[model samples]
Target chain A: MTDALVLLVVVPIAASLFPVALGGRFERIGWFVAAAMGLVHLGLSATVAAQVLESGVISYAVGGFEPPFGIELVADGVSAPLLVLVSLSTLGVLAYARRAGPHSNAFYSELALLTAGISGVFATADVFNLYVFLEITGLATYALVASGRSPRAALASLKYLFVGTIGASLYLLGVGYLYIMTGTLNMADLTGAVASVGYTSPAILTSFGLIVTGLLVKVAVFPLHTWQPGAYAESPDTVSAYISALVSTAAAYALVRIIYAVYTTKFLDEISLAGDALVALASVSIVVGAVLAVMQSDLKRMLAYSSVSQFGLVVAAIGLANETALVGAVVHLVGHAVMKGGLFLTVGVFATGLGVRTVEDFAGLAAKAPISSAAFAVLAFSMVGIPPAVGFVGKWNIVVGAVEAGAWSVAAVVVVSTLLTLAYFGRVIERMYFTAPEPEADAVSTDGGNDAVEVSFGMRAVVVVSAVAAVVLGVLGSDLITVIQPALEVYF
Target chain B: MIDLLTTHYNYIASILLFGIGLYVVMGSPNLVKKIIGMNIFQVGIFLFFVTTGYVDGGAPPVVGHGEETFVSPLPHVLILTAIVVGVSLTAVALALVIRIYDGYGSLDEDVIKEVQVDD
Candidate 1:
């Protein structure tokens, strides 16, 4: 059982290498092996979750060495849920990629490596190891984004790499500061040392600032988010969907861990200004991102900006630092991943067949591809926080939590942002269903060539599954809250 | 002031190097120079960590007969890993730069942006 921890992190990494090693001679074998590895990872994560729920936290020291000396992997309720989310989403995305037809085998291999790296970020107990995993994930993501056919794809990827490297460098600098202060790299040990040293030390504060800023950049929070819309819009559809689901979510999770696990509530209380600063940035991000999203003409770019808005909501909830708000943050994290991933994948299907990118291109899509269109409508409504959708549940918790924390401004922002969200996506829905297609262009194209714009069964399956999951997760909101409560308690 | 300098020499150097790196990454018009700046920045971090592990006048962490009084080996190991990650990033960034050069025939971001807009 303990060895399972090592296997969970190691298997995907090892498998990622195998496909590359085999090269083109065994492409089918590579895909099979990659898909199998994803399934196995999902199974292992599920097992880890079950054990974590039953047995409290699970700690595995690498090579049988003790912590504060050797690298350790720890899984608490919080990590377990994220681990499961990462694995399951990887599996779904891998399936979608396979069905989408032959991409470079090397790309899938890198995707697997990225998945491994993200899982390692969730699982690793050493701060420096987290930095290493972050690098791996960043490298893999740049490659994935640059794999797109568009010339702009390379430019977007380059920008992402440049900003992302800065973020990574800042993170390393922060880790260096923490190491200098504590003389240890282990997260658990650093937590005690940080508390003992107190938060007033210039070194600790510098580290906190660097780490939070680096993570904010990674999360694409507000001003640092300039790289994201381009990266999200230009990447290959499957790549965009996978990254949309996980990258910022993982960064947000790391931010929460740094605040709650590494620094603790006591340390945060001392740095009252830091917490308030984060909340303020998150507030600005929500309003700014929502406004920018409304102005976007490109459908994918619109959703990308909307993600910036959604991430702000999640970060603000985390910054609030109450149990209810933390729960809201966690739920929002999961909710956004499913809804955004589904929406992106659906858009991918549309773009693949219809050659659509802008909002106007989607006119009358609901009539052309009813099932995919309907799925998009459900997801769009969910993104707007409409009832019986995961987005609604997430927003409801966040709003309720804000009120409980007596953060009336945040509560009001949440309501206003929700309305803004509905306006943008509602406009998209109207364009898809209500607007008429140009008759002259239609007459020039006989056989109703537009009617062939429907997605394949497999792609439709992925959309339906995620769409259903989004609704079911919301419908079972109480159950999710119950499960997430234990995780949220650790923060409060 | 001298005592503070002596005690925190590595810290001062780390900040100085970090600043230099930031200057190049942000200020340099050349793409390759920015990458070089990134490398210098990473080296600064590596140095900070290595220095943190040094107990004053302690021996190297080569375990031997009766040489158990050495500085910690952990930060050294950690920096080695960082070096590998840094090198990997440099390789990828350089590859992207090459691609960008191919696309725009220029390495300056402003020039590239101008060309892209013209296109």
Candidate 2:
């Protein structure tokens, strides 16, 4: 079992080295190599997920040593689906990047590195290992952000690096506290040790505070999310879509792990402040992110702000700390990745193909780029929580879960946040479907001057497929729950 | 209070370094200094981890022919890995700063951001 787990991370990382070696002779060999690795990683993850589902949890210690000593890779109900999710998204990004690319050998190398880092995040059972993978992911993201080769991209990436480093440092400091108190780095050992030390100890509380702060910054929760918009807006199109879908999704998943796996629900029960503080922050993020998204004229920046709000819903569900709410968190997580990733891809198509970047520039996009505009609308509706879409189902479960948990205010915020989401996307939808394309205005648009690159069939295909998947996963949400149910039972 | 201060001086020093790094990172407008601040912050975390691995009267984590008390080696190994990561992160950040400087001809955050808005 550890074989597949190790292979899933090692494949992409090891393959990334090949592009530089081979690309010296063949210019676009990076494309073929990355695609091959992505395909292999996807197959390995599917096999691993199937094995985990059929049997129970599988924990394989690396280097033939047992846990609490050697690092362990676990593929249980919790991480198996996420393994599938990150792999699928990586492959989808590869497909999209083939058409719309920075097209450098180094570009695919960073993509491969990012894929390896995320899979490691999804599977590692050691807390310090998680920090290592987090930095790896941050480094890849910083490089990829600068790959756009613009001054703005460089500055944005620099800002991202500064903020991301501080966040990771805070997390390392928290791990230091955990080690000092418990003298263990393994997640399983942490639970018993944390309980023995008492959850209310000032040291334990401070560690929890630092850990959550670092994760929230990574998660891009409201006020701490300053780096997100610039990085997303200024990066090359494919990088924006890829990181938007997975970076925060992986970080949010880590937050779930910390809350439930490392700290445990009992910890939250002992000290409600730990949970309450997160809930308050999430509630503010939901409103503030939506309001900010509404103000952004740039489509990609608007989508970036929308992510702040969407992740707020996920974190709120996490803070509720109920079984159903947690389920909603996972569902919304999967749903948001597909929908938001698809939206960014569509924006990429518009930006590269037609020089459209602003919302106004998207006037009557239906007539110009019909399939992608339709794809955009479908994903937007899903994001708005329309019925039978994955988005609606995730929101339904979360609202019901919040009510069941008697967090009346949280339930209210969840409901209101849905309307706020529609408010921002509604105008874009209206303009796409109803408004006619303005006849070639000469107004100084804010889009960076490089425009009208050829859009390939693979780029459009990836967008359509993700849009369809959002609807399909919505219908199959209940079956997906059955798969995660076993892990959830143990987790809660 | 006197005993607490005397006994925990290493911890207090680490905290002071952390606070100074935080202030420089948040308060300064210079991009390169901010990166230096980031490095200082990581140094604080590394110091904290190393301090936790210290023992009052214990041998280093190497084997003798007999039973012996030793400070834990796990945190040392963990800190080594973390320091590598910190180095790589600094490399990436400095690379970006170089590019930004090349593009805007200024290393000031305020000037670079203002230029981005104007463009």
Candidate 3:
């Protein structure tokens, strides 16, 4: 299992390189290699998760050097499930991409690199290594966004690159500060060091501020979310779906790991101002994101903004920092990924088949494409936190956690946001099912343009699988909660 | 003042470099220049880590007799990894800049935006 852990992070990256290097000559073979590697990666991650559940925590020392010296890869209850989530989602996206079309060989390679980077970030126990993995993910995503043929896509990629660099730089600065205070980069060691020195010190506070601020930018927290809508709107539908599902979720997961694992609840209790400050920022993000999302005309852009709001809820739940709230945040992480991934993939199918870009363009979609539209409706309902969908389970936990934390105001914001989410999504649902199709020029020219393009069986398969996961995950909430609860025990 | 300069020179340099880089990233109109600023900022971080490893008048860290008086090599290794990351970032940023120039015929962000609007 120990050796297998290293393979989990390394194989996908190595395999990704092969496809890009040799894939041009052998297209089918390249995809086969990538898919095979993804399945192997999934299998290894699951094995690790099993071990983590049965045994306490698993630590792999790099190069035979122990903690506070060489780099370490640690998997606890917190990291194990996330590792599985990243691998599973990447595999799903890769499978989806295989039949979608012939993406540039370079593009697919970058996507594979991104998979490795995200997996590394989740598994590594060293803070600096985490930053390196972050860069890998960031660079790959920037390229992926730019791979779209549109000029707007290039522009969006540029903005994302700029902001993302700043975020990474700030995070590095925070790490520098932490290193100065603790003289160690190992997370387990740093936790002990931070607790020993007291969390109220100005240095620790400064580090916390820098780290949290940087992560907020990555997570696309409210005011810092200017780059996301454009990026999501302009990227190829397949790329947009995968990134929208993964990037912010990874950042949120990292933030939780840092706050709960690296800096214990005791440290946070000592620095009460820190928690309050985060809660305040999260509240602002939740309100602002939902409001902005409600105002967008473009379908993908609206979903992108909706993600900004959904992410805010995750951060806010984390800020609440109680056990129930933390579980809510984790559940939200997984739930939002399924719901958003399904929605984006469905939209991709619509855009490809119908050439539709705006909500207005979705008119009578339900009649034209019942199965795809049905899938979208289910996802939309899930996004609105309707019962028996995973979204509701996550949202309900957040509400309960907030109420328990005596944060009734935060709970109220969540309630209002859910309604607002429904209102915006409801407009689209109405347009697709009820309204007459507007005779747009593009619509007239192309036989519904691409909108008439039927989603492939394989594409439909991916959508149905994710949609079913959303419902099933919601129904079996107790099982997920049980898996996650052990993780929460370490933090709370 | 001289004592302060000598004692905190690395700190001063890190801050100065970081500020300059930040200014370029935010204030420059040219996209390429902004990328340059990013590089400068990263170099500042590199310096910060290297400085953290310094022990006054110490030799390089190696396992041998008389190596007791040596600065820690750990930060050096950490900065080495960071440097590789920095290089990768530079490559990606430059690639994006090239693409932007291709799309808009200018490296200036304002010009690019104007071109986009005119389109």
Candidate 4:
């Protein structure tokens, strides 16, 4: 059980190679292998989460090397829930892919590799190890995005590779700067070292600037988010849901970790420009992302834009740098993952069953796919911050935290974001329930095939389960804060 | 200004290399050139990292040399791993570039955009 943190990363990475190695006779067994491994990952992460919640932070030195000299894996209060989220979300997507998939051995291999990479990002206590994991995650994602049949998938993947590599490189440079200043890469050691060097030093300022900017690109903030809409829209539906749920969420979590764990809030208090700049940027992203989402014609593109806006809320919470806001960041990170992942899977259901891909095609979709439409409506309303939903709980905490911090503008922007969320989602909901389906929609099958379009049981179950989890998580939001309170105590 | 440049010439050179790489990546239209630019940019960072470990007259970090002064081997080991990562990244980027060329019959970003629009 103590070794669960390292096993959570190593098991999937080692298993990833097996799928590709099992060539001729065992080709079709890849999904089964991946599924079994997913279960193992779930068990391991659940053990880690239980142990972490019961005790305090669990730290393991690699190969018995101790302290600042060796790489360490940590399972703390903040990372414990995220570890479970990574396992559950990936397992959920794997189930969906069982029915709707490319289903090749190589595809499953990439999926397993991606799981290992994300788990590594969450587990590592070393800054440079985080970079290596970030690159691993980026590499796996690019290949999965390009797994789509269209040539456009190739284009999107390449663009993402270029931009994503640059982002990671910038982060590496920041690490180099820190190493020069503090002579250590361990997160815990850097905390003390950074404070000793003084926050007003130019080297510290530059390093913080580069690190935050690099991560914001990965988080897909507006203006730095050109690669996202195309990648999400062009990839396979399973890929879209998996990456949308985990990738940017992992980056946002890393940002929060870097801000609170490494730099600490004292740096923000001393250098007020840094925190104010983050809040300002996040505020702009909030308004711009919603407006862009409203203007998008394609359903997947709109959802991609919606992520930009949602992450703005998470980043804003991080910038507020108080216990309430920090807890809100963690809550929103999990909430957004469940809601957005569910929304993407629902989009896939519509596309697979009724040949619907655009907002216009969704007119009276309730008649054809009653179950999916209901699930979609529930998830969408949850995203719009209706009371008793996870989205409302997250946004409420952030708004109150901002108000307490006396950042009135940020509080106002967060409130306005709820209505803006309603703006784009409301259009879809209206077309879904209120408007009538077109007469010629029967002939509108874009694939030009007469074969039956089946919506798999696994796919629908995942979407419906996500909606249930969203509302259930909302009611349990306070419990989440209580669990994470110990971790917040270490920070503030 | 001259004293600063002379004293930290390695840092200045690395930053300049990084700047040039960024300019090429953002300015060039060809996909292959963009990837080459990425490599240059990464090498620049590697140089900066490796140079940070250099001491004036310190020997290489092989133990039992009976030398009191030794250049820090940590950054060297780090850059070695970084170099491996850079090579793999370059290989993947080139593979992606080949696929783009095969699919669109062009390596230029502008031409690819026009081809996509026509499709």
Candidate 5:
């Protein structure tokens, strides 16, 4: 039912409180509650996606209030994929976190809250409502990042809180500007209201600047990405994989929603500066992210940097603003989340089972943990744009989209960044398969030795499943494009 | 310039508050100061939203109050929600700061970084 759209956000939020309320007696029960809620959330997300894909965009006014006055929850092709991603990643990460954990009622509660926040962001039709959800996501994420054992995690989380709050506030300020100019907060209503004010108007331009800039910080695009690597690297492994997959992905998805739904392509056409700046930053992020990723010895930090590059492609696709490019952006967004999240989980398996946390520690990993190593290699190669993997599918679409839009520079960067991707992932692959295990690795292994290493069935299954999904989704790329086409038509 | 300032003094003041808050957050070495700066920055945005909802000689937006010009109630509602969000964020931030202080025995950002590296 269309009403399921609101349920997608509301159910998780209400469920999030249960874990904390039952904390003292049911400490370990948090995972079970979260898992159960995640399943329900996934079902709700699927129902919404199916209805939207079958029909068109599904818009629901909360409590039967009409749009442009009361808040609206919307789900279309764009949101459907992200909604599913948020739920799926939540479920997947909970599986991995079952054994590898800060397994507190509090942690699961935060995870459920994050699920609620991200789903809310995807579902909301009001700009100010988007801000509230962004904060909710921000708060949950900051807490999760701090949930790590180290004091460093608290510092990383604090830094993230400060930067992330500023970004969200800036977005709110932009909403304020838009509200003053158009006297409306609803995305659908603001589209017409913004156009009537003229794209070239100073207020409209300022709002666009503020909104996009704010979101870019959340997306961790290049220069604004300072809080990301530390947050990703320092957090508990489950937290890293979960946030790495969904948080920035949700923010980037919001970027797409705002650009297409509210500003429309006409604004980009009128203002060359806007599109150019986005493209420029994205290009820089791609190159710099890859370069930094290659320089990292820490595996988690490497993946964090790699996310910056991958999201660059997504943002670049959004900036290209063509039908094909937008398709590429969505495909890449989904692909990157799966691939990167899988990679982080795989790294966690190594860290937990083998005490291996650095690129150097990856040498001869295939011998000890064949399944995870193979999965890691598969994901890494997929990230390098190997065929039949979702990563290659996403990159191919983005490159084709970039060329179609005459964005030769972006296309070239897409190609070059693949090689840059290879440069980083390749070394890990080489270490995994080719190099001999270090003689002193036994001394270096955090758990004592390879003999003592014991990875749970759940952790191994999730990473392997993600690797398989990356390949399968790539094969089904055309079907995905077909499903999303109708939604794209409404905008382009 | 004077006329513009007179007409939009609230806007100007809000912008100034925004800039000052940002400067303190970025420029200060103290951890607590950063959180204070964050609150100030949020308050600036709240002020801007409230200013936008204001109307000259407007009555409060109460149902059936029968005022010809009533201030827009939406922005105020949104700001109320944001203020709640801001308070939660501050609470979480200070909790982290306390943990950080207990761990490293200092509240200075530079000192914490130094201690962190030494760890």
Candidate 6:
């Protein structure tokens, strides 16, 4: 009976408008408003998760208009964790941004809007509403990427804009076909409609191609990932962390939704090519993304490409189409968000305090900025699939699931992906610990005197906290599975 | 052939429009032209949705007293929202193009890339 699901989106959006509409009287309104609303949002999403855990799925129809006619917001085992993750990460990024900040009211507004859009993407049950929210997320992302006061950031943002628009448009076209064929916009209704229309129809085939391609572009799969590196590399560190953690995570979530909910396992049973192509594509992304990550000298760009690969694993798990793998996909999604985002924040600390933006610049990082370097090492190892870390748990589930399914090739890729991950992250770790510092350079760059770099307490805490969560959440994966079991059973 | 062309001409036109837009977006070097192409692409997709709702001789989705039939209004409403989203995208794209032109004195992405490389 709680409207928490709707308010999950509405609260942030409502707060987002305040800094713009009423900020003239108040000075520096963005961070306060964002932080306050973020806290409320975190609490609310936690409540929603608790409710969903106790009572199956919690569905809130907008304006109390019964579903199928009006939009319905559902929080179940599937969406509840992601809802908490989205709000929690938004608040975390806000905390990191508090000290390391663009701190403008407009920036906070866009961040809030992005939060709202992501929550909507997670909660909405209607296909068209997903598109609207997707665009909202994209639009907010482009503006936020451009919020960095540099020309390259603008260019990168523009590039992201064009690619993202096409991706979204293709999705809209898919929806058009779906509507034309089925005449219902609701996801649950579409599941029945799609089956009744038959899985192998030309229209259904076209819808699949357009819809999956559209989402793949957003997810930044293999060749479609051109805009990603530039966008991640050029944006301000905080903004990159926010988008990197949430944007594609939400997109991947949508893909899982459409595959499991709208199309259903029945669709996969009929058109095996859909699942096969996804597996093939994700495997390619896994290998190629790691290769690209190894090739990049730019640290943020490397992280961006790593994301392409991590998401590849999730996509592949979904492609595997088993109970264990699907759960593995969800775990990996959350694991990557925590580890990758923490990596970005640590990099931000490196850049702000020590002017280290490139991999080569990370030389002797342990000697100068030990805390940040240590935090980076922890996240990097977690990302490299160190056992007992959440990353390892996710990889293990996917590999085991792939093996159980007798998809030997997919299983091999899921296993080999660990070594591929290490190949890139290993270099950074090596540089940090094994190399000697170039003396007199570090002290001059951060401050004009002979003093250590000024890495803020907040910056250090966030990095440490995420590194800690990377391990702690891993140990709690079994608990996570219990919470997710109900949602998984219903979807399957 | 002629029968297929006329009855499904709207779909054909929409596809053609999309192809043209795609070509312009991919082929052109001018950043603004790319944005224009993007706009055309969106409008093309909008037409595709509108065409789906078109019923033979059905009145505009208005409900009159005891009326039994009308065109589907759902896609139309969806497209309206999409059109607004499209507009905002264009605005942001133009703003970015302006900033790039200001920074590098060129709207050609190749030239901008070159300058960025040199820097």
Interface RMSD of 3: 1.3
Candidate 1 wrongly placed segments (more than 4 Å): A440-454, B1-7, B65-69
Write down the TM-score of every candidate.
Answer: 0.95, 0.98, 0.96, 0.98, 0.98, 0.97
The candidate maximizing lDDT is 5
Candidates 3 and 4 compared: the better one by lDDT is 4
Best by DockQ: 5
Tell me the lDDT of candidate 5. Answer: 0.91
Q: Taking the tens digit of each residue's C-alpha lDDT, what string does model 5 give over A1-492?
A: 687899988888998998899988776889988999999999999999889878878999988889988899999887898898888998899888888877789998999999999999999999988999999999999999999978999999999999999999999999999999999989999999999999999999999999999999999999999999999999988899999999998899889989999999999989988998999999999999999999999999999999999999999988888888888788888888899999999998888888888889889989878999999999998888999888888888889988888999999999999999999999999999999998887577854544343678999999999999999998998888887777887888
Between candidates 1 and 4, name the one with more favorable lDDT: 4
Ranking by DockQ: 5, 2, 6, 3, 4, 1
Give the C-alpha miss distance for residue B22 in model 2, angstroms: 1.0
What are the per-model DockQ values? 0.65, 0.91, 0.72, 0.67, 0.94, 0.90
Which scores greater on lDDT, model 1 or model 6? 6
Q: What are the runs in model 5 whose C-alpha is more than 4 Å off?
A: A446-453
- RMSD of candidate 2 to the truth, in angstroms, is 1.6
Candidate number with the higher lDDT (1 or 3): 1
Over A1-492, each residue of candidate 1 has an lDDT whose tens digit, in order, gives: 866777888998988987788776875666777788899898889888898888878989998889878899988877888889888788778777766743577887888888888898888888888888888889999988988866678889978988998898888889888987887888889888998887899999999999989989999999999999999998888888999999988888889888888888777677888878888899999999999999999888999999999999998987887778888788889989999999999998877666666786788878878888999999989988998999998898889988998888899998999999988998889988999877654443343335343456778789888899889988987788877788668656
lDDT per residue for candidate 3 within A91-114, as digits (tens), equals: 777767776744567776777788
DockQ measured for candidate 2:
0.91
lDDT per residue as tens, model 6, A18-62: 877767887688889999999999999999998998898888888
lDDT tens readout by residue for model 1, B1-119:
99989889887998789789888988998888988998888888788888878887778867563564788777888889888888888898888888888888998888988998898
Q: Which run of 10 residues does model 3 chain A get worst, by summed lDDT?
A: A445-454
True contacts kept of each: 0.59, 0.95, 0.68, 0.39, 0.93, 0.88
Choose 1 or 5, whichever is better by TM-score.
5
